[model samples]
Target chain A: MKPSSLLAPVLALAPASAMAGSISIDLPRLPVAEYHRPYVAIWIEGAGIQPRTVAVWYDADHRGDPGTKWLSDLRGWWRVAGRNIGTPPSGISGATRAPGHHTIPLPADLKPGAYTLKVEAARETGGRELVSVPFTLPRTGGKGAGNGAGGEIGAVAVTLP
Target chain B: MANFIMFKSLALLVGASALALPMTASAHRQWLLPVATTYSGEDPWASVDAAVSNDLFFPDHFPIQLAQIKVTAPDGTAGAIEHGITARHRSTFDVHLTQPGTWKIGTEGFNVMGSFKVDGVEKRVGRRPGPPPGAMGPGGAPAGTPGGAPGRAPVESVALDAIPANAADLKLTEAISRNEIFVTRGAPTTALFKPSGKGLEFDPLTHPDDLVANEPGKFRFLIDGQPAKGLKLTVIPGGKRYRDAEGGYDVTTDANGVATVKWTGAGMYWMTISATDNKPTTPRATERRMTYTATVEVMAP
Candidate 1:
């Protein structure tokens, strides 16, 4: 089945209020010798303040060694907040996703200020990439998008209402 | 002959060859390069290599003495060095990072080296067979002799009061050297970054383990617990064997004793700084030489 079809149901289940402020992430499929789902982290950060994690997707369950063992591979996120948040962070962690568009709801309690949304992805035996989009709180008129350098990630779009 | 003697004493004081001095470009640089500066998982082990070589990160000249190395955990407690081995060119060791946060691995050395004259005969202060046990004057017990490495020739100098009362031309030089690197098992911490307020030290505005390429990293230098002004800092990236040119830069401290560098690329970097001053905490010493060296890995942005 097409990966985009898998997102229809997830989008339908999202609360109407969450649709007001949400981020859409696209994981690009690449032609390579070996394939593995990329572990990803999404977070919001502002000037002079600690970053807030939005979502983290990885192989939460493995037989012997858990996927958290390689979270540091996502250097950009690990250095900022992942290391402190601990494994399977309540309410923010999920299983790894297949190649396609994935939408995540933003926190409603975010204060009114200028902030940046960062999406970082890392894969085994593959390259890492980060995509960033700057947005202001309290609902801006249009949508913002950032394109990754094109390795493990594709395009990330943010919609603020 | 006097120049050669001075060179040997400087080598003994710093635990490397005379070429290891920071001032000379042709000099051999000393460093402790880790396999990786950051790690994750339930149990992670960090392996490090210690050497003095002409090229950065390539162990070729001589292995740093394992005895001089020390490890400090994030809680300011002593860490252990395991499975240590010294090869022809480099010394290797393993550190099992059982605790979370940052760990420090390196060495600190202090020695007094100079010459004095008794009965018109010039006698060196630091060398094999120091003054007799009786020569240790009241309250002069050869304090701070750099780790007392076993089986190695003792380089401890005689105490100030141990010098003959009739001794003339009493000249002494105090030397302090520090070399270190930081590794983080999970999250980076500053518990191991506290300055000892003695000799040359680091007051990092940016955590050493959190450095990133293309971003400015600010670090302050301190001498005797105070800001060090006009100090020269040299940073050289590793992998010199692959590049035709030496990719490194030099920066000087401002009045605030802070040196800022925006790394050009991502890799391990060797940093070094040296200073000379007449201020000596030990009595009768005419001058002091201080040197600090560190190896840090910069992540790609």
Candidate 2:
């Protein structure tokens, strides 16, 4: 019997998070204002609106938790993509992110289907932008690449990886 | 430090020569950041009085652990304001030097560090936050960062909604409502609510609370008899725990519609929900909003 088993409960406190396939969001270079990294929402939309992943490069959750609460701030994604949800579901989440690059993997147990990924960005004193990427994941292997639907507006839907 | 409660009165004198209407009655609310100083000088250990846009009733009711206040002084003493949150709107910071200088407060200046121009100098990295690096050790991976570190959890979902005209309004919504994550294994599941729609301004977590408000206003816990107040709330601008002081707060309303005292440092916490009133133009009474929806509607029928 491995002695490590004795302290499994203590180890259980630190749950292991799944590495969902990451997504790369490219910001548009606006001539006018500075573009702060946006609060991007990636979710599997079905039965109206359901949020699967919230990738806010700039906000926060519990105490020091970081993530996005300003789904509406992502102008383009707000209309059809990142709206309705007020808080995140149990399990995994955090505060927001700063201006730069962010990568998030797809959930292994993600129900395979026509899932949509929504990306929205907003700066406190600057501009707002949104981009949606739609993808279809394989039932078994987490193999896929998100389609790049880059632009600026209220909502832009991109196909799944 | 002394506390201040600003009774915002947004009186917009609009000349409606086109409509020929008598002083148009528009409801308005002034974004009043009533600052108080422990010692008065140019900036004298000043703290920008922040509310969760909602007030918190109990200790567990407040959110927003700490706030990152960045200021660029005229002489250029480049430093960010780190305020320890307390009972929602009742928050205060040491005010560092408390000297006078030009200050521009915003979210995410440069990287995770507080980087602003001080006499044309930049910090380049996040300031030396408190609580040290250990706090994030359990879940300190740069959240939302693609291929983030191991300590943190991966983002499971992200969706956009209700795109606002300007970034500030949208950022406010994100800062208040959508940006929350509850730990299942930890303290019985907490929901950190940032009453304001800005980065870590006022992020406070309520025990076992999964719901929060996007717009500022009054909110009832429903589970408890007390109402969840919406003062202004925030978290450490970045998820950096060291920068945050008390972790959360709420501005509970007393009989005079103000908080009791100022915010001092404490411990870990979540977001706060208070009565965040909308700045209605004229003819509009102080239109109050509740961050969390209640069974009883305040709308006068």
Candidate 3:
């Protein structure tokens, strides 16, 4: 019963359900002269959790662009999930994107249970990648959210027809 | 007569193999000038060759010398100014640019090896896509080159105000250890200069991969840009001097311009600095040079 007492009741039920629930992001495809459509970031976590950054994209003026300098090749989405999205609530204040495919949505006081999805890609002279996906949210009105180890085991699916 | 005594023992064996070599100066060495340390390959009037090797302190290896080849034009009309050069060897470090882009030739002589500088004309070495104040590569077609633009009237930019290039400094103050994974690159990273204060005294220990220790002072270093030399300077510490424990800071310039270097010793030492207008050509010196590079951390005193 000690992972620090299971992290003190999951940090007292994660800031009270950590904002209540919703998410979707599917980007990944490259090849156009080795590839030149990079600069992406998306966030959320809780599976070994500690990441929350919402969004980031770049290509503004293209001078060999490496944005945040290869964004750390996304190392397992920056250590299991962007160090748990440190400061994230909204997303990218500075925008820029071109090569295609991008979709963002996951806000509505997000809270329920299982949630960890992250993606990071950077390129100027080339290369970087990070990916993580998981889901399970139920209980805004209450009921639904199931999956031990707390969320995201598939490409990300939080079914609730 | 025993063939004239074997030709007098082959003339004493060819004068003892010409007195065992040595004395090999043979006129003006090469001078491609990328800050002059020996480089040749920029090609314009085409003819950049220098090799006075074994560093004699670059005064142009005497031998009927007179050299003078300056280019210095980073948007400041000191464009291609060539003058007097004897002791020949494929000659012509020329300079007659009406103007275009990137031109920093700079060379001088008192027999050879005096000045330095390179990276002239429409620059393009390889793989450099965004990593500065402004760089967004993949701009579509600049990959190989061809008539990108050229036809006179684009050569009147010489706003070099002699040397007052925004007082150089590259911050130093330590107290790291939240996780221990720091990084460095060309000190202060404005591409080797500019960090007199806060660009990053601490930003997650600055990690891109950090490894910019641009060798000691590199030599003849820059001033208006860094390690300057006219208003003279020598404050080098924009690198990881072995991760500082208290060892970073060293500036050098004296005779008047008051250049002193320090940082004593400690951890993370990748320190680099330069600023040369420190003049010295025997005609009583004072030509010009400008270098840069910054990385920080020093905490041992």
Candidate 4:
């Protein structure tokens, strides 16, 4: 089934309180011998099987669409959310970021529910790592955040503010 | 002058012979199969079909004894596999799945030995198991040097007059295979994916139990405890059906001993790493070659 058709209803039912909130994630630098910008896959895995992809930081060089092939290496998100969606999906995809903190704002009209922010990274000739943060978006809206760490991608956090 | 000319031609041919030869090792493939892919509900049970065959991808026939098999549950509890009915092609054994998670099923400690005879003396090669005392014929090579670890014996033939009188010549080959299957009664745990660090282990940094297709991931290699750099690991999505498919994933561990590969389509992936050394064992074969194999189930997209 197409992910858009499934997300359409949930997006429309989202309340106004969640609109002002943005889910920012911190992507820390690692201390490995070799370093490269990791292709990061950030998505929200809800109570159900389908997930809402927030962003894909990848090699957007687009010279011949070379980087698109390795995007699937983000196995967890690719299988569940990235495959069916458009390659770049315009706003949702962008060039990879250097090691530091980055933020992805939640959809203004997203429905309230429990979700796990799964952040996975993979780099060529480097290690792969995953960090997950569980959170909930109550319709009433307040504050929610979580943090995790990995080998390739260091400290990772998701915050709703 | 004529003899010198003939020797020069022979020397030139010998120097270029390797380039003209297609050398392939006479190697066998190991396989581990779970009766069913996934089991539901409480008290799930699993049984694996294990075999070693000359053909790496097919069970056309079994050519070697299975030797030993063990399964480590998700909780890190390990137990010898209780063998059940055996057939010409495979051996079946039960795996306890009292806890819900991925179970690491494996086989190790099997040696395939080969040897030769010179001057009426049979020299044992492969593994360190020495022949019985007084079993050697008079004037035969003593059962290896009676000192430090056995040294490598050349697999190739040596001149009879060149054979040492006190030490026997032998080459030892070892095999290790690791297979995994996931059982879900509820949530999965990290305990199921921990590495034993015994042989060539692929400690998944991507959580093997929850692998997803199109997901590029890394698995750290531990060969005999330390990081195994330059270890060759081949990842076949459908190892049993390898010949039936197209390109398979293959990589060598970096200096850090980590192999990274991305899953395209989901299926059962068989990853094998093999290594050899010229150094012989303490009491047995002249040289040793070791191999490790793992069967990973990649969940479909």
Candidate of highest DockQ:
1
lDDT tens digits by residue: candidate 3, B161-186: 22122312311111111101112211
Q: Could you report the Cα RMSD, in angstroms, for every candidate shown? A: 8.7, 27.1, 25.1, 18.1
lDDT of 2 by residue, A1-161 (tens): 22222221110111113443545544433344545444555555544445554443435542554343344445333333333333444443444554333455555566656666665556655544444455665523434433333232222222123
Model 3 chain A weakest lDDT span, ten residues long = A4-13
Q: Write the residue-wise lDDT of candidate 4 on B125-213 in tens digits.
A: 33333333233333333334443124634233343334465544443333333444444323355675556655556666765555657
Sorted into a CAPRI-style docking class, model 1 comes out as: acceptable
Top candidate, metric lDDT: 1
Return the TM-score for candidate 1, rounded to 2 decimals: 0.81
User: Between prediction 1 and prediction 2, which has the larger lDDT?
Assistant: 1
Of 1 and 4, the candidate ahead on lDDT is: 1
| TM-score-best of 2 and 3 | 2
Poorest 10 consecutive residues by lDDT, candidate 1 chain A: A5-14
lDDT (CA) per prediction = 0.77, 0.31, 0.32, 0.57
Writing each residue's lDDT as its tens digit, candidate 1 over B119-163 gives 877666753332322343343333224323334344334655678
Chain B TM, every candidate? 0.82, 0.23, 0.20, 0.63
Report clash pairs, candidate 1.
Answer: none
Candidate 3, residues A74-160, lDDT tens digits: the string is: 434433333233222234523555543334446555556677556555555555444455555554543322221111111222322
Please identify which of the two predictions, 3 or 4, would achieve the higher TM-score against the true structure.
Answer: 4
Model 4 DockQ class? incorrect
Residue-wise C-alpha lDDT for candidate 2, range B1-301, written one tens digit per residue: 1111111100001101101111111211111132311111111343443222221212211122234334443344565556555454334443354333223332222111112233432222212222222332433433224544455444332222222223121211111111222211111111223233322222222222122233123222311223233233222111122443323434454332222222232221223233333432212123322332111001100
